[model samples]
Target: MKSGVTNLFVTVIGLAAALVPVNSFAALGDLYEADFFSHTIFKFTPAGTKSTFASGQSLSEDLAFDRFGNLFEADGGSGTIFKFTPAGTKTTFASGLSGPFGLAFDAAGNLFVADASSGTIFKFTPAGSKSTFASGLSIPNGLAFDRSGNLFEADDQSGTIFKFTPTGSKSTFASGLSFPVGLAFDGAGNLFATDQSGTIFKFTPAGIKSTFASGLSSPDGLAFDSAGNLFEADFSSGTIFKFTPAGSKSTFASGVGNPVGLAFEPATGIVADISTRASVQTGNQVLIAGFILTGTDPKQVIVRALGPTLTSFGVANALQNPVLELHNSTSVIATNDDWQSAANANQIPTSPVDYRPPDSRESAILITLQPGAYTAIMSGKNSTTGNALVEVYDLATSTFSQLTNVSTRGFVGPG
Candidate 1:
């Protein structure tokens, strides 16, 4: 029965070209922006409503959540960690450190701090005892833990990462990073870190490092969403990027004021810490430039239109039926089609009934039309049982085209 349903769905999609005109309208929705310098965090819901969670912290660079639902903020300016309870009571959990930038908690509830000033890592037990876990580092800024309780630190000054055993012994896990800062771990024990130069690195537990993603402007803090997508906070551009383990990165949020930190709360989606600039609505369109998928698997991709005027667009897949849906500010507004299949060479769209694929070397989907503010959302999966690469472009001048060549696993959407 399931197979029959699937086949019917495929057949409907295969006949989509004849139904093209039925899929091109949209509705507008709410939008929100964050001011990093203002120390404010704004939330935008599906209904277009906006809310403020917190504000007024001095140069907050990283954030972590405790078991009690409290938000711990690393105030790099004050060299302290500020704890904000669920009730909004703020207090300094630890202070008097040299540029405390990143914080992490182990399974035993011990808090680890990356001190950039002293080039060391400090461990604070739940009872508040401060002890040096490792010292003589080179500007350690981000910290994470593996399944074996091993600690990983990203040294920004040396562009190296160190792994500390449970016995306080440290070894070089990876080196030659471009000012690596933020660190996170996938369930498989692989370490992911971001550099201040707008790149992401993946390292094996034994110390081999590889470039995971690039083309960012000062990618700082890193987080992972529920779907295993990595999120990055771009300090220079005031934006957030959502990347896949395969190496594809896309803008998750924009117009943020120098976003320096990122955290994912299952209950709140993604939280970012803006360290510089003021929050303002710049009226700039959140454009999806392109994407890359570099892993060993083939991936799938789906594209959607978003925003108040999203209903004005529809997706016509070469092998599927045209799907028309209303655009929600928070909802993905595109059809679920095999983007990899649509990317074949010399492919073209013949009304709502015919379509053609471009060459394999072509990295982007070219759409020539009038200019206006728009957002393009894409999801990718492996074509050969692994992952996919789908890149979208915001074209202007009718001849200006967007391009993406990254071959990593992940989705790209408007932030």
Candidate 2:
């Protein structure tokens, strides 16, 4: 018999409350700028609303965000690196550097700084232990990391962009530039550099270089948002320009005082869960929810289907027994019929948050997934039809990965 479901609603809950500070107010996808002349860090929303994120730096040169959303600033004028909580409390992360110019964070939570005056790159452990990572360059101005953990640096005086292996083996990635000051990498592995000569350049993973944009006013720092849009700090013109993936340009913000560093807060907040409440049925009428895991690290998540528990939440026609199936690109990866009987039932309760199903007949699957797309489908056992709630919960939020682009599909109208 053909059946349908109506009012199928889906909600993606981001665990931002745990990562964002009480006083800090920047949403994900917002752009942050280090205003050098203003001695302030400015926050610009995606719609161009401006606010002061942090203030009182001697000379804010570059900005980077740790996994926890804390902002790190390079103050070249004071030769110090300042760390600011999301709420704006500031502390010195490192000091005594010779003209700190750039900041970046690797997957391991280590911080890298470019010391322009000393022509060196320094690495700092999470515990504040410092060590020389690379040296003897000609004015290292900007630092960035590729997915493979290789470090890229722009040498302002040498007109070259150098790539360094994890062990500091250096090789020139591109050359013949005019004062390249800022470096960034897009999701597709392409490198972008801002040349103070009023131009921006793009380099493929194989080192093929081409001009991305030209006729800028001393473009200094560049960064990419999750959507692959490039934001450039036009140092001399006091404007921020955004370029789309296809090279279309537009103004993102203006009237900033010598913006030097630009960074976009991660678009996907730590995902708490994505829940879909729909009428569960059999065959092609079942509820299916899809999501993508992005970034370079693996993420642990719990998928569950709640049927009887929905009765307590005003769902009267709840399915007594629900079934859940997880898929990776059309192949069934896992399935569960009862939450308590799953092989990893013991580990389900230990998730970062308590996410145990209330009824023994409910279904749950706890698994760790690599960066990819996945789907979870929920249905009623024995071809029965009723209301059911399917959910996916992220358990490992500290990793450099996130769950995003959640969607759902099901038949329309009640089954």
Q: What TM value does model 2 have?
A: 0.66
Tens-digit lDDT track of model 2 for 201-281: 999999998999999999999988655678999999999999999999999888998999987775554666778787776
Query: Which candidate number maximizes lDDT?
Result: 2
* Model 2 / residue 20 / CA error / Å: 25
| lDDT for each candidate structure | 0.53, 0.82
lDDT of 1 by residue, 155-248 (tens): 8888888888878888888887778888988645678888866678788767677778877787778766434567777778877766776767
The TM-scores of all predictions, comma-separated, are 0.54, 0.66
lDDT of 1 at 150: 79
Q: Which ten residues in a row have the lowest lDDT in candidate 2?
A: 17-26
